[model samples]
Target: MTFAFPRAVLEQHTAFLGKTGSGKTSTAKLAVEQILAANPAARVCVLDPIKSDWWGMTSSADGQRPGLPFYILGGPRGHVALHDSAGKAIGELVATGDLPLSIIDMADFNAGGLQKFFNDFAPALMKRMRGVVYLVIEEAHEFAPKERAGIGAENLAIHNAKKLATAGRSKGIRLMVVTQRTQALHNAVLGSCDTMIAHRLTAPADQDPVKKWLKSNVDKMTFERVSSSLASLKTGSGWLCSGEAQVADLVQFPKISTFDNSATPTDGDAELHVQTAPVDRDRLRAIIGDAVKLAEENDVPRLRAEIIRLNAELASSGASQTVAAPQEEIDAAYQEGLWTGCIPSWTCSRT
Candidate 1:
């Protein structure tokens, strides 16, 4: 059965909890797609540690909507460094309305890098938000673990995330946290959510938190029935519970309208084909101009240093010794829908 959420309800904090292979990502994607479809001005930021799971949001195949902007902070295709400046640049990009939907692939970063990026990005994003923004965190437990110890960076990240969960709503930053292991997530973050879309979960560790949270809203008999139903749910089927029973239901998601780029890769599917389209020159120019402007306005020393280093490298290589023709040429080429030189902090591919 299909379930639709109003804009008001969509803006509230939500959680997607289930075991692996239980369709948490797919359901979350569908919810995001619908949110964007219903509100053209809405913005979404996905923290995808898997790097490839959210590509469908940027895929423009037969049934998919036009692709969204893509940013790779630390992944196989990453171009942006994991420095604080780069993190802030991304936050500024989002805060300044430069990106509509941004998927940050974090698969390549080490634990330390991941923690630093998250700690830096959340505050920057909250600082300049002018409109409502949805922040989707996949593998939520990694960012906000239940147990704290010698992991300083992770603990810092968790602290920042908890702050966002508790206080970000006034700033128009909402969260959609996806996790396979509910027991491992920080209680503060989980407790902040008023809506939960839960799929099959048999582990007592996982079930207990859900039951504990629902007990206050659902009667004992209904809770038992819902608990049993949750344990036996098939893939793509789950219970959608809001703060109370009157607004909840069992939902069965239909086939997603976009390409499943996140599908598990098998031996036979090793060499898949992806469609590409011509880049939009005006959009590319606007993005570049905004990024440069934000970098200057934010006084990001690392970005400035990186730019200087790149210019020096170009000069020393004699490719643009006279007047740094490499960057100039790159800009000219991009204006003509061609990409040259190394990847920038953010890159857009048409498909």
Candidate 2:
């Protein structure tokens, strides 16, 4: 059965919670496809905290056709390098620019770096957005954890998440909070969601949020029926409960249009090999140049700035030649930072 998403469901804040191999991400991707199909001009931004399969959005389900041209920022497969400091700038860019699908793939970052990025990003994106924007926060629990270590960044992150839950609707921010561990996430954030699509959640703790949701939205008998079935729901199937959509149904998601790069390989499967769809190199490079500028010190921005300065100088001198910055300069800057051990902000800022 094909699960349909109403605009009421899409525009309002929603939570997608499930255990591993339960097809939560794929279900979210189905929503994305539906949204984009409904409004091709809709702005969508995905923040994948790890080396996730969101890159599959660039390829068709068959891995043969060109899918959406989502500009990826940082990862082993990213076009632009990502840094913790870049969070503030990236968030603003997503809000202010007319860019295409933007995916912030922070696979290279550690736990401390993730906290720093979320600290800077959540507030910036929340404040800068003026139009209707759809933002997907994968691994939402990590950014808005129930247990924080009393770190300022972690506190700020949860603060911004709570604000996003409470105030983001009036500001035209459509959010999807996706996580495997719903109990680990902030209650206020999950509770604030108008809709919750929960797949198979086996653990009692993990099923707590859905239980709370069901109890509040449905009759006692209905809630009991749904709660009992939480652990045995089929893969790709979920209970779509939403007050706004007026939906409470067991739905099955259809096949996604994009490649499923996140699928686990079985023991008998051959070594995985994939070839993503094609893109315009020149155009993509131009877009990546803008994303590259989001990075701060000891990064590509300074080097690019120096190259621009040299190009302007050449132009003023009536010279037709322009040159890129030397490799030695970038190498020297990186080496200096490495030796000094100075990037303290991203290393967790406890003091």
Candidate 3:
């Protein structure tokens, strides 16, 4: 049965973590596409670091009723190129900076070359956001590892994302961080999400994080065994956890029908071949431009700066920034901090 998302928490942000060939990317793409198709005003931004199979749609930016878009970054020849709807080359953006600091708030931490993209590109795109802005990230551990517990850009990003997950719902920003190793993700990232999608991860160690993240709501052994059993689930079959076990169930995607029937060769009737059109470059550029424009109008830079400063401050407190606190308490602390800024000397410390 299909599950419905709560309107109050309508901005759906999901984390699909699974090993290679587990179909996390394909599943995310399907869900986002469905969201866009259902809502004409909807838009999405994807941070594709590896330029995986999803790159095929990069050239079709100009077509489709609500055209889909794509942008290609790392590939052979060591240069980043932006393609348009017609598969035509447009221009290239510099690929430089520390990788860790690229996407999150680094505060001069280990932010490799990716810093250039996040600081230069991401801010611009987030501004023009319209209906919904979903962030689809794979290999998330590279940015947010479990072992290192300190202040960094990756940590900052996680912090800000969690904040957004809790409060950005009304602001129209949604995030979906996909990874094969669930344990590697920060608790803040997982905690912010209302829904968690698990694929065929067979290890108990990997599933341990979810157990801790979900608390007594889910048992470690049961989740591990359930996820491990996914090998038998038809290609697209998987489960959705929304805090209630009675609602979650295995689901399968319908076979994709293409315009050119001849293009699809006859195969085993059981295995449906779903064709995801190549990434659309022109559309991507347009979406990025639109998102950037929205962010600009809504003071995205200022908001990000606020988040950056708050993150840095929290990092200095000598406590885990991902520490789970009640919403009321968090708001109280924020209020106290604001009041402290107004009142010259009295600072309230966490009790």
lDDT of 3 by residue, 1-351 (tens): 554433322356677755565666666666655665567445454555443433323222222222243333333211133211111111112111111101121122113433234433443333433444556655666545665545335544554445544665555667777777787777767676666666665567767765554444456665665555654544545566555332344556442211222222335431133332454445444533543333233332343355456656777997545433334433543642322231212232444
For this target, which candidate reaches the highest lDDT against the unseen true structure?
2
RMSD of 3: 18.6
- Candidate that beats the other on TM-score, 1 or 3, i.e. the better one: 1
Q: Rate the local accuracy (lDDT) of all candidates.
A: 0.70, 0.77, 0.46
Score candidate 2 by TM-score against the native: 0.80
Order candidates by TM-score, high to low.
2, 1, 3
Clash number by candidate, in order: 0, 0, 38
Candidate 2 residue pairs in backbone clash: none
- State the lDDT of candidate 1 residue by residue for 89-162, as single tens digits: 67777777776667777665444556767887888888877788889999998889898655548878888889
The TM-score between candidate 1 and the true structure equals 0.75
